[model samples]
Every structure is written in structure tokens, then in C-alpha cells.
Target: MSVTTKTDGAGDSALVFEQRIQDLCHDELFEQGTGSEVAYDLISNELLLDGSARLNLATFVTTWMPPPAGALMAKTADKNM
Candidate 1:
């Protein structure tokens, strides 16, 4: 495979988006690794069908809260995990 690079609008090399070996990812990992951008885009697209947590009333865990508490939790997420 060949990769050619050009500067993007942000002046960063656009070669990563030129990935040519990508395949659909599902229960198994791709035999050829897709670049991070493609992987993230696919995963996020898959998650688009999922319902928003705040709209799920049956969940036992807290879903709706003030912004400050959510921010605090987000800040300390690594420690909490």
C-alpha cells in the first residue's frame, strides 16, 4: 500500500485519513489496524443508536444531575474508577 500526504486546512499532515486497509469491525478486531480516526468514528457511529442516559428512566444509577456535580465526578473519574 502507498500513502501520500498533503497539508490540511490546519497545516497538519493529512496522511492518517488516507488509510487504505480499513475493514468493518465488530465481534472481532480488524486484521489490519484502522487508524485512530476511523476507529473512533466507527465506534461513535455505532453508539449513535443508543439512548441518552438522561432519558433512560429505568436505570438504577443517577442519570440527571446539576452540571457542577457532573463536572466534579468527571474530574475525579480516574480516582473513582
Candidate 2:
């Protein structure tokens, strides 16, 4: 998603949050694996423990990203069979 924010404007908080979340998703923790419920649960717990902002970030990613990624991976695996 595209996020735009002015440096000294009111939306700065949202912009920062989005940037932080984007960074988190690109971190090593998320890079190690995908599609494992154990991994998802662990990540979810970690974010939820981090307070509301991080929790929201985790929720956003989980809701928006995982399903499509899972579907694509499944399709690829099926094609390879």
C-alpha cells in the first residue's frame, strides 16, 4: 500500500507506524518461514505483547498479506506436482 505523509503534518503518526510495520515485515524473523501456523502464532503473540500500535500492525499484515501469500504458495506447489 502507498502511504504518504508530510513531515510536520498531522498524519505523521500514521506514517511512522506504517514505516515501522513495513520494516518489521522485512525483518529476519518474518523472512525465515511462511505458512506455518506456529510461526504465525508466535509472531502474533509477539506483536500483541508489544502494545497497541504493533498489535495493529501485525493485524494489518496478517489480514492483508498472509491469505494471498498462502494462496500463491499453494498454487505454486500444485503446479510443481
- Say which candidate scores most in TM-score: 1
Across residues 1-81, which tens digit of lDDT does each residue of candidate 1 receive?
559553222412244345553456458764545456655666676677566655655445776889998898789755543
lDDT tens readout by residue for model 2, 1-37: 5596323333334444354333245434543433344
Q: Positional deviation of 56 in candidate 1, in angstroms?
A: 6.6
**Pairs of colliding residues, candidate 2:** none
What is the TM-score of each predicted model, taking all chains together? 0.33, 0.22
Quality of model 1 by C-alpha lDDT: 0.57
Whole-model alpha-carbon lDDT for candidate 2:
0.49
